[model samples]
Target: MYKELFIHRLVQSKEPNTLPKLLEGLFEVFADFQGITTESVSSTLIDLTFLEEIRKLSGNINIAFGKTLRDIKCTVNDSDFRKHEIYLRYDSVKKLRIVSVDLPSSSLNKQTYNTIEDVITAFLKQISNLQSYFNELENIDHHCVVMEPIKPLYKDDYRNIRIDDKTWLHLEVTPDGSATNVHLIGQSEIWQDKLQKGLLTWDQDKNIVENIYTIFDIKNQSVSPTLIPVDAARKQSSEDTIGPTCGICYCAQLPDYPGLPQPLCQNMNCDVYFHKNCLFQWLVACEGGRPPAFGVINGSCPTCLQPISCSDKDC
Candidate 1:
């Protein structure tokens, strides 16, 4: 039995640049499904359409990015041939559809899926390119910041984030400084209580005013499946370009910037790359006469007086 994963009500966009963001909002609306990953099952190739859309935007939006990414599709196989095929498509009109089907068995030796769960798991593995697509979608380039999951920034201990985790919350701080789309993961019933009463504050300074806390009211909150607008995800705009070497440490091998391969220079002129830790130490040193650093900063480009690359999305 196959069903249609339909994205309800399509919205037209005149600007291609805004498509990615719309796509983002679209997924946020249906972020409540539970998908599992299983290896043994034979599956079909997934659609690659939506992903192509993301790639184009990823190049322009330069926060932190992952090469891998998003897509659509349908088909059938014979009885014995237990084949699982999936495809992703992004039409010129801007709609995404994922359709699954089971055909009659072909041969006696071919394996067949015994249950829908088995089929679903195989389907997830095929479409598991989310981490990459999202990596770029939430590119700090699109907003004020993507608070790291590091200590003092964002902290959580609800283990079991595997592809199969029954209950989880994949929080993405929206442009409005709110986690509007809490990927309600596997099941909301399980984690709703904790999220409502948990001590979840955004910064190290947990004082009510100093910290950006998250309020969870499962009963009152409404985050419809939404679209991702690319207006907020474009690449560097000349002034944000930076050097190949760290202006401070003169280093190229910057510490791993999570999803990014290396640290980026935000200076208009390309000069250096730096380990974030190195950059932080340098920034701290520069603020010698200043008080203990408080929040993140978008330092000025030594040459242009503009903000540097990968510093802060808002700058």
Candidate 2:
């Protein structure tokens, strides 16, 4: 009975809805077979209808189907038996889909299958990476200290000393009652000098002494040797650049230390600079009030639009 109804639907319908109707008819036939009402079968088969659509869409097309479906290809034929290609692809979010049909190779051809395929592929890869990143971040403990300042040693010249942007100096207590100094940038002359001068002392036994010194400095001299946490320190380093004061805003202060507002770009690799907040407003005005995304803004220098690459020369 199901087969009879399926054939009838297939013969009557002019489009792909035939598959759905046939599946619906099958539920009715099965209901009769099991002595159940057709109305009950219709209500119970709703979810199955969706599954059937997925199966049918995935079967006839050369597509990849998993939790996400993609890369659907279909063949079309002309009246004269000439064949053409129709391609459909799922979007990056997997919420939208795009379809494209091949055009004849001509000078006026406005679209190409390769271009569509490339766009679909790129979007998928981007969304996939974003999903993976968020998933990984879910496991991260954001409450832990993200940044710490390395202690400056006596023999260390403060000129060439800069904090590394990527490397985190984690303080760990070792088994030998000493602080283990695991050099991340490897053996450097600056590091060696600092280690010898007792600036970068990781000795757990000396923690009390260091604490005393820090407290004394804070109490007596009004100087806190530790500038910022590891994360803030890195952020400050990235924000600081040798530049001129902004002509319009006159905010010329470079990010010499943490807890200070970052300056805006003065010019392309030139001196003029503004506060980050000021620059953001400037950009919004320049772009007619619709600023680009934060990721794009962070990715490039405001002055040059070149990619920002932070380096660790000193700290």
Candidate 3:
């Protein structure tokens, strides 16, 4: 069933661009659905109105067929043109529209069409793999350290103990230099009843005052989540514009510093920066605990959400 179709103006090209070639290429792909050979599909072209709509939908005019074109107007070399916005519209049945537009004489050549066709073919192949494409989108919600915390210095007095021959004692020194140690009196049930929690004393400034200890209530303790500010992200990037910015935070600006851990996202378009400590905590928070370091792969730019890749050169 043929209906009225519209085509938009072609983009000005130094050589023939992909628009026309893509249309021709799609004819082959759609032929199977229409039960016809590529040659049998009519090459009938449409008008400028169609092109205008296409420009509206996709920000870029250069796209392959089967991709929905939006309604919009675009300017090429100061000339106004309209392109079809949506190409594939389904109401009750599927339909394909073809539009004809002028190609620059200087830009037209055999090679240009072939290149355009190749691009279209590749794009179509990707489209055919719908399940894979969706899988990628589904996987995009990921967490990574845009910034890692600098290791806090530990006090010299604190020492780890091997409880029994199997279990090791877990010890933590507080900011005030007070040490909290959990000891295993024994593995047996009777010995477990004899276990006692130990605490070291500290002065007003939090310095160790004495070795006198007491049992600690380890079960009732609550820790607060660290607050990460947006400004910190910018500061890191500002330190070195050349370095990648944090994907979680977008505040780092200009001339990246050396020796600092590389940022998560570096692309100028997505320019997000993060503090090392902030990022590490964020990863742990998102996963409900500290996750293994190796699981993280790619990270998204905090600003644009576009995936950022590691680069050898500074941004």
Highest lDDT against the true fold, candidate: 2
TM for candidate 1 is 0.21
Give the per-residue lDDT of model 1 (tens digit) for 1-315.
Answer: 011123222232222334457556545543432252111111221122333434453231221111112232222232323333434332222333333222112121132343223433454443342333222233332332222222111112111111111232445432223333344333343245445454443443332112212333222234322211223212221223332344555653335543211223433243333445555555545657342334454455443455542232211
Error of 3 at 14 (Å): 12
Each prediction's TM-score versus the true structure = 0.21, 0.19, 0.19
Question: Once superposed on the true structure, which residue ranges of model 1 sit more than 4 Å away at CA?
Answer: 1-243, 254-270, 274-277, 289-294, 298-315
RMSD of 2: 19.8
For residue 180, give model 1's deviation from the true position in Å. Answer: 15
Candidate 3's residue-wise lDDT over 140-220, tens digit each? 111111221121111122232222222223343332333455343113222233234223222333222122111221222
Error of 1 at 15 (Å): 57
Relative to the true structure, how large is the alpha-carbon lDDT of every model? 0.32, 0.35, 0.31
| Native-referenced Cα lDDT, model 1 | 0.32
Better of 1 and 3 by TM-score: 1
| TM-score result, candidate 2 | 0.19
Using TM-score, give the best candidate's number.
1
Candidate 2 on 147-259: residue-level lDDT in tens? 22223221111111122222222232222222334232222333334444554443444442243233223233223343344356445645755323443456544354321
**Each candidate: RMSD to true structure?**
21.7, 19.8, 22.4
